[model samples]
Target: MSDRQAYSGMAVTGIDAKGRAAIPAFLRAALDRNGAESRVIIAESANAPCLIGFDPAYLEANRAKYGSRADARLDAGETVDANAARLAFALNDIASYDSSGRFVLPPFPAMKAGLDKTGPVLFAGLGDTFEIWNPELLEADAKVHPAFKERALFCLSQWKKGGKG
Candidate 1:
C-alpha cells in the first residue's frame, strides 16, 4: 500500500540438520526489489508462534516509525522505554543468503519460532513481511486462519508422501 515491494505467495521448503533453508524464488525476487543485499532480518513474531522476515528497507522503515513515536511521546512528557525499544531489535537476527537463496537460520530464532532442526518450513507471505513456520506448529496453532491451517496440513501430508513441500 505504501509503494513498498510486498511479499506474496507461499512455499514450503526443507530445513536441514544445521538449520539451513532456502528462501523461495518468489519471495527472493521481492527482497531483491527492496534491498541491495541478499540479507534479511528474521525475528520472532510478536503476535504468532512463528518467525517474520523482512528486508533492510522494512527494518529501516520500522526504525523510523519507532523513532517518531518515541519522539512524540517524549514531547508529550511521557517516558520513553529505551529497554523496550532495545528488546524489539535485539531479538532479531540478520541472515545473508547466497545467490541460490540459501541461508542458515540462527539457532535461537529458529527455536523461538518452533522450527525443528530438520523438517519442512512453510513460508507464508503477508505483504510487508513473510512468516517462517514449522508446518506442524502452524497446523497446531488455533489462532491461525482456517485456510492456512489447511494448507499446512496439506503440505505436511505431501511431504510425508515423498513430495516436495
Candidate 2:
C-alpha cells in the first residue's frame, strides 16, 4: 500500500439562516485542482460535535476494508457496512456543491447543534476525512482540552520553522 497523504489546513466558514454554508474559495479551488469537488462524504464524528467530510477516494479505502465485503458468509467475516452506512447516512449526510459553491446542510441537526444560522464553523482537512465544527464549540473544546491547542500550535510552529517539508 502507498503511504497516507497529509491534508491541508482548516477552512473557516459561516452558516446562513437557510442552513447554507459557504466553503472557502481556495478550498473549492483546491478540490477543483485535485478533481475532488464533485464527490465527497459528510458524516457526524464519533468523538466531537462536528460533522466530518471525506473524499470519495478515502471512502473507497474504507469500503474496501470494512464496507465492501459484506456479502461473505458470517462464518468467513463480518461486514461493518451496515453500521457504517447507517452512521454515514443518518449522522453524516453527503453533499455536492452547486456551481455557485454552496452546500445546504440538513436543518434538523444543524439546528440541534446550534449551527442554525450565522455561526462560524471550522473546516479541518483530514487525509481521507474533513471535520466541521461550530467555532464556539471548537473554542469550548479547546478550553476543556488544552492539548488540542498545544498539539495544533506545535504542529503549526513546526511548519513555520521549516521542520516539516
Candidate lDDT scores, in order, read 0.86, 0.60
TM-score of every candidate relative to the true structure: 0.92, 0.67
Where does the lowest 10-residue lDDT sum fall in candidate 1? Answer: 156-165
Q: Largest TM-score belongs to which candidate?
A: 1
Largest lDDT belongs to which candidate? 1
Instruction: Spell out the clash pairs found in candidate 2.
Output: 43-92
**Count of clashing residue pairs in every prediction:** 0, 1
Q: Write the residue-wise lDDT of candidate 2 on 37-117 in tens digits.
A: 564566667777777765566666665765335545354765344665666455655678766557887665666555777
Off by over 4 Å in 1: 159-164
- Can you give the lDDT of residue 103 in candidate 2? 85
Kindly report the root-mean-square deviation of model 1 from the true structure over all alpha carbons.
Answer: 1.7
